[model samples]
Target: MSVWLENAIARANSTSDWLSPIRSVSLAALKDTPWPTRKTEAWRYTSLKSLERATLSPSPSVNQDTPEQIDGFESFNLVFRNGEFDLDSLTQPLPAGLMISYLPTASEEMKQASLDEFSQIKPGRHLFGLINDVLAQHVVRIEVAEGVSISQAIRITSLIGLNSESHTRVFVKLNKGASLTVSEHYQGNVESLNTGFVEYDICAEAKLEHYRFALQTDKAISLGGCHFKLGERADLNSTLVGFGSDLSRVDTDIIYDGEFATAKLNAFYLLDGKELFDLHATVEHAVPNCTTLENVRGIVADRAKAVFNGRIHIHRHAQKTLAELNNRNLLLSDKAEINTKPELEIYADDVRCAHGATVAEIDKHALYYLESRGISRSKAQVMLNFGFINELIDQMPNQVLAEWIRPQIRNRFAEMEVTR
Candidate 1:
């Protein structure tokens, strides 16, 4: 372990409420697992120099009077400032069948029960996850009882301010036949380090639609991941929109624990300048008749770089499984770079799975066709580029979400020059 991490852990031990066994487990894992480098397949195209060279510490407390709201959307909001939950900003009187509690305030019994549930989740050999276990300050828990459906969305926003580091954990549980829509937003105004981990356990026949927005400044460094386990016939729809950062990585893992589970993932990224964005996702089919579909699209401009890896695994007992993965990218400048890999592993002979990837630039003929109609070259190029991602944006679950995302993309295009 690095001296920096050792000191951080020592400081965390003085105040941590986690049981001794959990702390020991994290420390041992940190000692045995080496930090990732370019040689690591999962991190081959990404560099860790920026994160390792900086001094990272926990963020200070924040007091915000009012939570940020989405215009025209009647939603429940939870705000986290500088890695700590700002209870003062939350709306009172939570919806029926829903409970929202902070770990630091919960009783000992509640903390222990949450620890038990958290211990069952496997972070797939990520060192950052172990680090989070050691230093996370606040754990947010949300539970939805059986047969409950929330009509309004639940919005959770993470705002990082100044030079600080934060590790946050979230736990979500949905009982049988329950349904919920959750939107998570992450933003930072200054140079900072942020680590976020979320685990979702969905019971039989539950439905969850999760939307994530990573719109951080160019000075931020962010690492975030999500793990999901679905029970019998459950349905999950995950959608993500990411703008570039100095260094950012997002990981997603989904597994089926019962028969006939289904998961669909859709993602779009807009990268420019010298920003880097890395997205790694894996979907596992452990039971029969499960289906998984993943689609990712990206636009790279200037000297920005992006990495995408999508994997689908079908276990031997997972008969009659159907899965597909696709990644498509557009490069707007000669200096831009994109690395994409789509993979499939099927041990079941009865399963059908496929994976494909493509990277290309704007078509000159299309630009010329529009130019022949008396449109300016720059305007025509912007129109063509916008059309590339229009289909994906149209598939958003709600108009409010789409309205929230489109302006960012349009403003980005208006400020930059497009090249063939």
Candidate 2:
């Protein structure tokens, strides 16, 4: 093992008291799994050779503070820094029938029960997830009791400072017939990086709406994975909006274990400069009459690179399954790059499944037409780019989040002129 890995394992063993048995098992998985390389089929587009080549030391704790102004809608908030939960900053008197607490603060029985379910998940298959499993110090837990529907959204903000590495684990559970909206916001200093894993379970007839907004610094790197399981008649809707970073990757995996479940996944990303962003997702339909739809779009500018890999699987017993996947990319510069693959694996002939992928440069004819109409080239380009991504962003159920993301898209396009 590399020195960094060895040191991380030693630290994990020393601090095992603070970790659950399942977390300990995750550490073992990390030790066995090798770092990803070009040889790996799934990682061919994302070369982790540079990350393996560098020696990364453990980050030192610095002045941890949150901005006074969040510049957005008000809601119940949970903030964390450097993998440590800040209880003082959290909102008081959580919604009725809802519980939010740090894992380490829970009783031994509750912690162990949660760990039992958590440990069963396999993290060794993904190198970044394994890293998070070993290094995370705190785990955030959110539980919604049966028949409770939270009127207000719950927001989780993860902030990182310069030269620091933060790892975190999150678990969200919705009891039978419960409903909730959860939003995760990730922001970091120019020189900081973070890696983490999130696990979620939806009980029978429960509903979960999840949104992730990743606005990271130009020099930071982030790696994260989310695993979800849906029960009978459960519903899930997920949307991800990301602006590129030096290096960033988000992986999502969802499994339908019971009949009549439904899921929708939508994502939009804007990449510029030398930034690299990737999104990988898999949806598995194991029972009959499940439905899934996935759509992802990217706007690449300058020399930045982006990738999308989506897969939908239908089991032999999953008759009457309906699934569709599509990915589209708009390249603005000659040097910009995008790689997309849509895959479908079906075992039931009665299922309906389709996938499509496309990558293309901006339409010069459209730009010329706009220029002939006396519009500036830059303004025309922004208009076309906005038109490319707005379709997916408009699907967000939260108008507040949609409005907050619009300016980000425009500002990113404005900054691209300098970098290009």
Candidate 3:
């Protein structure tokens, strides 16, 4: 084991009313999980050597600035800074039949309930997920009672204020027949690195729509994992959009536990100016008649690098399962890099599964045609790149968020300073 892993294990085993089990599990997994190195197939393009060299410590105290509100959405907002929840900044009330509270401040019943499910889903499979489980301090807990449907969106924002390391854990549960929408917005100044973990549970017939926007400054590093479970006939839709960060990785894991479940996962990433971004996703179908679809698109420019790994698994009993995975990337500069993999593992004979991956640069013929028609080369390139990701962005149900993200996509091309 590396010296850093030893220290992490030692620190995690220290005193705390909570996190003891997490520490034990994390420490046990340290010896088994593979280190993310150049030789690792899944991590071939993303090297963890830099993280291995840096000494990581708990973040320092931080006072957050006032949060900026978005129009047209009356949301219940929860704010966190440096891994600590700021109760005073919360503006909206918890919906009827729903409860939202910080884990450190939750009641004994809530704490016990959370602990019961903390390690229920395996986090050791992913190195970053294990690291987050062992190191996260504050946790946001949300519970939706049976038969409740919340119309308002619940927004959670994690902002880093200084040059330090921080971690966050979030747990969400939806009872049978419950429906809700949750949005996580991660933004920070160019000061520090941030890491986080979020887990979700959906009961029978429940529905959940989750959207995440990660926009950090150029000097920041962010790593996160989303683990989820779907019950019988449950429905889940998730969209992830990332634009700004020096280095970022987002991993998602979804499992179907009951029959007739459906899930959709869509993601878009834009990187420029030496930024490195990665997305790893897995969908497992354990029951019959379950369906899953995954689509991810990325644009890289000016030495930026992007990686996408997508996998779909169908168990022996998962008959009649249908799954599709697709990953596509567009490179605007010769120096830009992209690595994509789409994998499918199936044990059931009556299942339908397909995967496709593509990596290419801008089409010179299309650009030349547009430029000949009195359009600037830069604008034509931007238009083509935007069109590449627009296919997925159009799937977003919230118009407000879709419009909000369009400008960021345009701004990324503008920052590249590419001209005809």
Highest TM-score among the candidates is held by which one? 1
- Predicted candidate 2 versus true structure: per-residue lDDT over 174-242, tens digit per residue: 999999898888887366557867777888999998988777857777888777788999999999888
The alpha-carbon deviation from the true structure for residue 141 of candidate 3, after best TM-score superposition, in angstroms, is 1.0
Worst 10 residues of 2 by lDDT: 48-57
Model 1: clashing residue pairs?
Answer: none
CA displacement after TM-score superposition, residue 338 of candidate 3 (Å):
0.9
**What's each prediction's clash count?**
0, 0, 0
What candidate 2 gets wrong by more than 4 Å, as runs, is 18-20, 53-59, 67-72, 119-124, 417-420
Indicate which candidate wins on lDDT.
1
lDDT of 3: 0.81
- How accurate locally is residue 378 in candidate 3, as Cα lDDT from 0 to 100? 76
Worst 10 residues of 1 by lDDT: 59-68
**Global CA lDDT computed for model 2:** 0.79
